[model samples]
Target chain A: MLYLDLTLQGLIQGSMYALIAVGLTLVYGLLRILHVAHAGLFTLGAYIAVTVTNAAGSLLLAALVAVPLVGLAGMAIYRLLYEPILHRPPFVALIASIGLFICMEEGFRLVFGPYGNSFDLSPVEGSVQLGALSLQTVEAATIVAAFGLLGALAVFAGRTRIGVAWRATVTDPEMAQSFGIDTVKVRYLNFFIGSALAAVAGVLVALLNNFVEPTMGSVPSYKMLAIIVLGGLGNVKGTLVASLALGVMESFGTIYAGHIMDRDAIAFLFLVAVLMVRPQGLFGKA
Target chain B: MGAYELSLLTLIGINVLLALSLNLITGFCGQISLGHAAFYGVGAYTAAMLTKAGIGFAPALVAGAAGAALLGLIVGIASLRVRADFLAITTMGVGFLFLGVVRQQEWLGGELGISQISESGLGETGFLLLVLGLAAGVFAISLYIKRSWMGFAFDSIADDEDTARTVGIDVARYKLVAFALGTAIAGVAGGLYAHYARIIVPDAFGFTVSISILAMVVVGGIGSTVGVLIAAVLLTLMPELFRFINDYKLLLYGGLLLLTMRFSPAGLAGLARLGWTAGRKAERRPA
Candidate 1:
């Protein structure tokens, strides 16, 4: 039962990881840029959610407000920060992303006063029970939200014309452009969707913790890098699988090795260990 | 010089060493390591422990460099398999792991960190002079490498790894050498830093420091050693130039890095070339 409880907890946590990593995978597929500031967007989403919820006194209203803004911010980052250097070594794009992330972190500290914010109006303390399993209202909502949105993403990618155009762009940008696929719009769409997912994850994390801080996105930002690698770079399905797997590993690691190292240390150990093993197909570049 | 001014100069000297160290790897070797601070921290802790154990400052700095070189070799082994973006993230993970270990271990002083880190006993001006001397030595060494055969190998590898390999250049060995040498220099800087302040904390070696050093290398013009040195000196002294800059250090560093990379990918070196070309064209024109 304890094991089951941990697995459940891990899955709920993994849903958020999946949300963030999926966004990262999308951007990497499209531009190979790594989109590091996506973490900043996650932090931004949490800040916006908390600020709006506090002012308006509603959670749904907060999500509605935060998601689109984050998505648009994502497009802006790509256009303003990445577009110029896209032709240079991929490392240049990465460095710029890091700078943007650093700027955003400090900007948050300056504007938000560096401490943290909590939900003033707490949601109902409800629990969901399912056949010898139980979950908090926050956990249940997070899981349901992840599934609903990721499922919608899958359907959109598989069925829609823009979605096909996106896949084409990812496979080969120049070829897709030659085919009149409008790869630039596809790039913006990629950022929009990916950043929106990150925003969703950020809001869920804020709700789960009931607090948001400037450095909230720091750990997850790097962990998603590990996930992208573990999923094999640019491989969506692999990323999804890796996210859940990492969440479970982290849950167990925190329980077992928590005394030996911090949660982050344990998680990064998994990254090192994964890189060392280099299991053939699982981590093969997409 | 006054004590305050001497200390500030010494601090800038250490930062120059760090930027030069990063320049060797990221600039010369074309390897991206987002977690270079781990090596810096390793050097700091190693020197601090040894100096506190009654070892001479010189030997402790040597030991610190050696310890960091060993860790670099280990990380470089990982880099043997991965390249480009994957390599960057892997190095970053290593950086995070270092911070976590330091924070958790009681002997590392955990969160409070180590204080009263034994000094080098070289008085104010003397210590500053020693640091400046070491910085100059590293600069000379960098210049030598830039003109040496190894530089060619590194350039080839950086330009294209598979092509370098096809040309019978040993990519793996050069990459490891860059990693080892670069990290050893960073370790030396870290050791100098520990004694300069006579206090050591994990926060001082966080991701921000790594990025700041990187900013120096990028903004200075990647492979251009002189530009990097100048940028390091300037960036170190920036907070002193503007009081508000101290509060927004990362923002300033991040902003400089972003704008520099976006506008001029080759950084100051690229800009200088542009100006030089324009001047030459004007001279050759019907003016």
Candidate 2:
């Protein structure tokens, strides 16, 4: 029963990881850029959602406000920062993304204070009793929302015209543009959807923890890098699978090795091991 | 000079070394390290532990460099098998792992850090001179490498690994050497920092420090030794002169980085050369 509970909890945690890592992977797939500032969107989503919830006393309203706000901000970042520097070396874009992330983090510290904020009313306090097991409302909601949204993403990318166009752009932007694909709009849409997904993940994790802090994105920033690499960089399904697998492994590993090494250490060891054994990534082409 | 001035000058020297070390990795080898502070931290901690346990300063510093180099070589061998960018992400992971281990362990002094560290027998002036000498030595070595056959191999690898490999360069071996040499220098700087500050904390060697060092290299112009030195000195002095800049240093540097990457990917050195060429063109065209 305890193992089942842990597994269930790990799945919930995995869903959240999927939510964040998917956004990161999407950006990397489109542009070779690491999109390090994607972590900023995660932090922003949490802060805005919690702040809105605290003020309006409505979780629905918080989600409504947070998701689109950060989504547009992500689009703006693409247009303002990344668009002009696209011609430079790949490292230029990378360093710029990192710089932007630093700015966002420090800005959050200055504006939001160094300390963290807590939800005045959280729906995640109690646990639901399932047959011989228990699950928190936050956990069930997280799994449902994350997987359901991911499913929608899969369908959108696989079935819809815009989805096909986005994938086409990812593969060969010049050819897609020559075919009159309106690649710029596709890029904006890609960023909007990706950033919205990150916002959703941020809010869900904030609900689960009942706290939103400035530096909350730091660990996830690098941890998701490990996920993207493990799933094989620029692969969405791989990221999702990798995130869930790592989540389960971490949950179980924590019980046994919590005193020895932390979760980040475990994840990085996985990254190093993967790099050693399969540098092309676990799912990447040989 | 007053004691404060002397200490600041000494720090400038140490930071110059750190920046140069990163310049070798990111600027020359084109293997970006977002976690360089990991090597520096390892060096610092090893030197701190050894000197605290009655080892001499010189020996402890050497031990620190050796420790960083060994770990760096290992990291290189593991990550350099794939794309160059893999090294970047791997190094970052290493940095976080280093911090996580330090923060959790009771033996490593955890968060509060180790204080009242034993100082080198060198007087303040003597220590400053030693640091300056080391910086000059590294600087000289950097110039020599710029003119060597191995340097040509590194430049080729930096430009395009596939092309370099096709041209018969041992890309992997050269990368390992760069990692080993760059990290060894970082270790020496870390040891010097530990003894100079007379205390060491885990946070002192976190991501921010790595970013600052990268900023020095990039803003100084990547792969430009003299430009990096000038940028390092200017950046190190900026915060000290304007007291408020200390609090906002990361924000300002972050902004500077964005601007630098956008306006001049070649950094200060490139901009200077551009201006020089422009001036020469204008002079030649005059009536």
Candidate 3:
């Protein structure tokens, strides 16, 4: 029963990881570049959501506003900084992303100060009775929200022309462009979608943690990277499975863990160990 | 040497070693390591704790380099196959895990870090000059590496890992060596820093320092040794130029990065090329 409870909690938390991982995986798959600033963008979303929710007293509305705003911010960043360096060496993009990450974080620090903000997003207060073990209402809601968003994403990708175009762009951008697909448009859409997903994850994390700090997204973002790699880089189902397993392992590891062996270090050790043993991750096709 | 001046030069020398070490890894090798600072922290914390436990500074420096090298070796083995963009993220994990260890482990001094690190042999000024001279030697070594066959191998690996492997190069071996050596240099920097600063703080060697070092490489130029040296000197001195912005120092630093990325991808090195090339072109095809 304890194991089950831990598993449930981990899976719920893992859902947030899955969302962020998917966005990251999509960006990497499409651009063949890692967006280091994605974490900063994630933190930015949480800050914006927290302020909006506190002022307007509407978490739902705040999500609506903050998500798109982050997406637009993502687009603007690409337009302003990345597009010019698109054809340069891979490190150019990496450096630019690092610059963007610093800009976002330092900009936030300048505005919000370096201290962690105790954000009061009204969390779901009730608990769901699940046979022998009871789960918090927020946890149940988290699972539903995660699966629902993922399901919606899958449906959108499968049933829509835009999604098909995105898939084509990922496979071969040059070929897709030659065939009359607007590669720029697809890239823009991917940026927006990826950024918005990161934003949603950020807001959810703030609610779960009950605190929002300038560096809040750093650790979680790293964990999500592990998840994406553990799952196949571009495989959605693989990412979902990997995230759930990682979440449970991490949670149990934390609760029963020794002082010297932190949950994070152990998790990363597992990641590094696994990667060493299996260079391509468990679910990775590559 | 004046106390303040000596301290500033010592810090500058240490930072030069760090930024140059990272240039070897990121600039020369074409890998972006977000956790480069972790190696520095590992070195500092290791040296401080070891010396506090009665080991001399020289031995402590070796231990620091060895410890950081071991950590880098492990991280390199795990993620060298990934390379570049993915490597950045994984190295970040490795870096954070290093910090997590420092924060959680009791032996590492946890949050307080290791204080009262012994300053044996040379006093403050002697130590400063010794370290700075040692750093100059390392800089000379970097220049040698930059012009050698091994340097070409590193550059080849950086340019295209798979291609380098196909051309009979042991990509992993080169990368591991570069990673280990880069980290060892960081360790040396940490050792010097611990002695001079007289206190080892975990926060000082966090991601921010990693970014600053990378900025030194980027806002300077990727492969230009002199550019890196100039950039490091200028950035270290830039804060001294403005007193009012000290409170928002990091914020201004961030803005500097944004401006550098947008306007000058090649950094100060790029500016010189811009003028030189434009002048040459004018000479050839003037109306």
Candidate 4:
């Protein structure tokens, strides 16, 4: 029964990780730079959602408004900060992203105050039983919403014209440009989609935990970095698999190792081990 | 000078050492380590623990450097197969791992951290002098390395590892050496900081400190020892001078970093070189 409970919990967490990791992987695929500020955007999305929910008194409406707003903010950040240095060394863009992260994080603290705000979505108020196991309404909703979003994204990327253009830009921007694809527009679209995905993950996380704070994104962002690496950088399928594996391992490892093997340490150990054995990542192509 | 002013000078010296150490790796060797503060923390904890165990201050400092260098060597070896972005993320993971370990261990004082450390019996002036002396020694060593054959190998590796390898330079060994050297100095700086502050917390050595050190190296001009030194001093003192707008300090830092990278990627040193050449051209034309 305990094992069953843990597995279900892990699956829920894994779905959230998958959402965040996939968004990060997409951005990396297109830009070849780690979007460190994506974490700040995650926090921003949650805060925005909470504010909107408080003002309007509807979780669905708050998410609907916040996701697109954060997505636009992501595009604006790319234009203002990253576009100019796109030609520079990758690290330059990374540093700029770090700077952006600091600005956003501190800005949120100044505006929203340092205290954690209750998400107050008041999600379904109770738990449900299934045979020998039980699950919260929020958890079930998160898993369903995560899969729904992922499924939608997979279809969009695999079938839609703009999505095909995004994949082409990722695979070979120069060739795609020669083929008359507006590489710049595709890049902007990529940022919007990726940021929207992150915002969705952020909203789900806030809803699950029932709280949001400026610093909430820091650890999760780093964990997402580990997930993307473990799943293989820029590999969406790999990210999903890796996120689930990581979530399960973390759940089991923490239980077995008592107090020492914390979630961050387990993720870090997995990262180091994977990096040492297969630097290209488990699913990454050489 | 007053004790307060001397303490500030001591801080500048410590930051200068940190910037110089990061400059050695990121600027000279072209390795982007986002976990430099992990080494800094290692040095601090090692020194603090050793001194608490009845070891002499000097010996504890040396032990701290050795400990940090050992960890750096391990990380460097692990990072050999990885490239730029992977290396950055790996080092970041290592940094977080260090914090996690320190936070969980009760012997390391856990979250409260090791405090009430015994002083080095050296007054503020003595500590300042020691820091200045060490800073000077590091600068001199850095200058020597810049002019030596080792510098050529490092430059080659930084410019193009494949070409450097083809040229018979041992890239891996050189990179490991660079990591050891950089981290050893960071360790030294950490030891000094622990003794000076008499309190060491894992929080002090988080990602923000690493970024601040990286900022110093970048703003000073990577590979320019003098430039890094000056920038370190400026950045450390600038916050104290602008106490009124303390809340927005990090925001300002972020803005400065963005502007500097966008406008002058080579940093202050590159700008100074441009000015020097332009002045010379004007002088020659007038003559």
The numbered model that scores best in lDDT is: 1
Worst 10 residues of 3 chain B by lDDT: B78-87
Per-residue lDDT tens digits for candidate 4, residues B38-73, read: 999999999999998889999999999999999999
First chain TM-score for all predictions: 0.96, 0.96, 0.92, 0.96
- Clashing pairs for model 3 are none
Q: Which portion of correct inter-chain contacts appears in model 4?
A: 0.61
i-RMS for every candidate:
1.3, 1.6, 2.4, 1.6
Q: By descending lDDT, how would the candidates be arranged?
A: 1, 2, 4, 3
**For model 1, how does the per-residue alpha-carbon lDDT over B166-209 read when each residue is reduced to its tens digit?**
99999999999999999999999889889988888888898888
- Model 3's lDDT to the true fold? 0.80
For model 3, residues B90-179, the per-residue Cα lDDT tens digits are 787777677777787777777888787788569887888887897798789899998999899999987888899899988888888888
DockQ-based class of model 4: medium
TM-score of 2: 0.96
Docking tier of model 2: it is medium
Give me the chain B TM-score of candidate 3: 0.94
**What DockQ would candidate 2 receive versus the native complex?**
0.60
DockQ for model 3 equals: 0.46
